[model samples]
Target: MLVPRQVDPPETPAKTRVLFTLVFLGSGGIERSVCNVLAGLNPGRFATKMFFHHRPHPKSQQDRIPQHTEVVWGTDAFVYHRKMLPRFFWRLIQEARQADVIVAGQEGRAALLACLAGKLLGKPVVGMIHFDWGAFSREQPRRQLWGLRLLYPRMRRIVACGHDSAKAFQALVPVRPEQLEVIPNFVDGDKVRVAGEAPLPDWAVPIYQKPVVIAVGRLENQKAFDVLIRSHSLLRASGLDHHLLILGEGSLQAELEALVKSLGVESSVFMPGFTPNPHALMRRAAAFALSSRFEGLPMVLLEALALGCPVVSTDCPSGPAELLEHGRHGVMVPMEDPKALADALGRIMDDEAYRQDLSQRAHRRSEELSADRALRAWESLLSTV
Candidate 1:
């Protein structure tokens, strides 16, 4: 008897291999956005790998990276020196060879390295702009600006986290309009809500006992935590009784602490650096405040809206006004204006009906900027690239 003829199995289409490169894996909005993209992407359609120029610090959110994606750490230095860049580029080329698409997870050195690798390998490179580009350009060195001018135009796409960021990039860089894409940062609303429901730590229990105005961000100059501290003092002076809680860690911690002390609001202000679950604090806080001098699309502000926490943010460049819909969903005050910030915070903390109205609008706005919508946009971009 003859055996049945053997039949071959149908071939499965290979997933698009995406290589994401970042300067480091620190606790910043860019890092968080990378982690979210890695986890949220459809695994069947895209395979993700990350290359970090420097090893993550102890406080880096490395644990949030998905298990399926491969992560490569290159160096330990906070910033790569010119002498070390040759080696970094060689390693990145090796990584880029295996990827179909290269993503510069952030601007600056990461974008430079990724662009170099993409050019060498003839791969499409997608660069990300995560800050107000005009402000960023002013702060960066001439060499950095030169690098952007020379390399960013070579990218297949330049993604700005907000429309204002896109406009800023167009003004600063001579990239074609078609090359720019404005895909605002987004968070997993369900996960954020779940995290928000977590029980507060023992030490933080008393801080939340009094109605608190919460702000979550690095203690860096851009975040303008000093402005928030000053506003807290103003609110106190005006007879609004509310504690101020600023979360996250950075170089300006000491300076900000000194500011709090100098203003004599240390008793009412708390700086608990780098907690994993700031959503919990935001969930219970009377108001969530953002006093950033500038931002691309603040992840913390989105997280606050996701939790339906009342928001009062500085009408800073790019993100907050857009996220808050020009004061439709939340209050927007002038940047670094302590009195305006203080008044907004007081309004939220004082008027229960108005706070509730903002809370309702916040939840609705979050749905429009949900993780699923962002993931779909990313998938479309990756597929085409």
Candidate 2:
């Protein structure tokens, strides 16, 4: 049995059973957060059901949903309802009422379904806000349609990942300020290995004595690797010979590769693809870099800092500023500006003393966001619901 503590510290409750349901767990920031929550939740008090979406039969997401979590296949994320709404509801109606509360970290169509099912079964539904509520505000017509179809106002609460996200969500729902809670993404920093000099690869240690400029993210549009490639090109032209090694893979491979070739910096850029132990990589990296167009609080940046990796990231609207505490912990360059990005990267790479200072501050700041602390926050929220 999986159980999570139901009461806040200093107070004890007799008993409470809560079910945390994730309606979508596709590989992304939200998926990562849900995974963290599942892995971090106290198994003695709460049970988790992580639902996945892509052609759900013989589902693979179940394999990753953490052993403590009860992975449910053909669940809401699959939209099995589109094919058999009444029959699907017949099955889910029972599952919805099996706990004191149903936590849905859902977005898009799945959210509407979770809200409806939770309401019909008289279960408290806490809708988790992940990405921008919509392209603009929470009141996007899609939500209005969901409200009309599901009468979504019946759901109990809306949990947001940031202040801006909370505001966007309330713009659509008539939620009180107290009801929209802002909790940022976090990692178990204690588990993070402090970045000490690793035995550098035989070739890299001597040939390129400068700290390796490292960036990690999928090769996707939102990640903006092209911008990083362009910024790196500028950095190289300015005589900063440090090699750029990006870790992760995506469809943008051809375009990004051509950009590297066009910029004539193929020799300086390396893609080692997806790395399972990014924390280990961060430990030995000269610095961590992010050049994203937008983000919902990046997990990799948080992990990098915990590993003592000095960071230089584009000042994307909400995520970086919140994570770096307005550049107190790391360098934040203006978005989409290559010169600004290059200058920041150059400063961090060339100014050894400054980079060291930032690295220490980052590691110290990340220490507070340990898995235990994050779990306690989740515990507090679930207790109230």
Candidate 3:
């Protein structure tokens, strides 16, 4: 059964429509990201709707979204594999005949579907890209040829989440660098800050009275929480009094738990699974840590800074290095270096002067990504198109 949307019904006053189509919502970074975008968008300027391929349907994260937007459920999670591919295209044509814009991420089933739907409806579409599809796709050539070659040039604009992502988008299309828009993820700074300041809940493990380090991301291989765990074990072995808290879940949970035991750092490491309010935890923690193998302006990095948490992130390509301003604002250890990460963690935990300096710089850096500022950037892009 599909989830019910409490919509106010279709009310296109000037027969104009704005739709943002996506694959799904919930359980992962991408889904949470789409929610943040949807949250920042003003409803008056854009009548937004999210079309999902698959969610935890009937009881999905979509259910929790404010009633201002409509969430439409699509039948196929996979573009070519879904039985209703042709029919899905047909219905998209039928529904989007008058839509002014269709927002889609580049090189996913959603993007392909949006491209097809736009062509059928004679509607202009915009591709929103974070990372290149080839980085994660099995049928790279098909997506590149059919999705990129055929679909990209036809779209009105391409939006990238960060500078690195914009570069990735450039590779997909022959469009000039000036044609792409690089809008960093926006943060509702005041709200996130307020939430972060609140005291921790009673259920949270109380290991970090003084030396607390926190990293937030799913336990997926891509997030490389395993690498962080291994690094944390090294930190503990070096006589550091710090405890590491990792928030979020994935299939690697059991493997990570086992590794913590084998490494004998169970007393100093805690995995409390997923928490919707990660900022709350981030605020109380002494510093924020990210160990992702790569990212498209990782939202957790921004959220941590906005909450006034000093950050130490892996200097992975894409976001953190840029966000840290080449090591001025936050510490950036080379990716997958246990000793380097341990050293960085130790500095943040043991050295107050350096940590406070980084914390101040982080706050200043976060101001660049204010939600209001980003909303204006979006407004500018929307006007240009």
Q: Which candidate is the best by TM-score?
A: 1
After superposing candidate 1 on the true structure, give the runs of residues whose Cα lies further than 4 Å from its correct spot. Answer: 1-7, 76-83
After superposition on all CA atoms, what RMSD does each candidate show versus the true structure? 2.0, 7.0, 7.9
In candidate 1, position 180 carries an lDDT of: 89
List, residue by residue over 280-374, the lDDT tens digit for candidate 3: 88887877888877777777888888877888888775788777787877888898888888888888888888888878888998887667776
Candidate with better lDDT, 1 vs 3: 1
Which ten-residue region of model 2 has the weakest summed lDDT?
Answer: 52-61
Please list the residue runs of candidate 3 whose C-alpha ends up more than 4 Å from where it truly belongs after superposition. 1-16, 55-66, 75-81, 84-91, 105-107, 132-150, 176-179
Clashing pairs for model 2 are: 3-43, 3-44, 3-45, 3-46, 4-45, 4-46, 248-273
lDDT of 2 at 353: 96
Cα lDDT of model 2 by residue, 1-385, tens digit: 8798787578554444555554444445676776777777776767666544333434324454679666553433454456655544455556666667777775655566677777677877777776554333332556554562344356676677766556656665666666567777776566546323344455444424555778887787778888888988998898877888887778888899999999999888888665445555567777788888666667788878888888888877457777788888899888778888888888888888998998898878787655676678777887787
lDDT of each: 0.88, 0.69, 0.73
For residues 1-385, write the lDDT of model 1, one tens digit per residue: 9999989998999999999998888777888888898899988889999998877777776778998889887776776688888778888898899999999999888898898888888999999888997777776688888888899999999888889889987987899988989787988899899998899989899987789999888887888888889989998998888899888888998998888889988799988788877888889999999998888999988999999999999888898888888998998989879999998889888899999999999999998886777788889999997
* TM-score against native, each model: 0.94, 0.79, 0.85
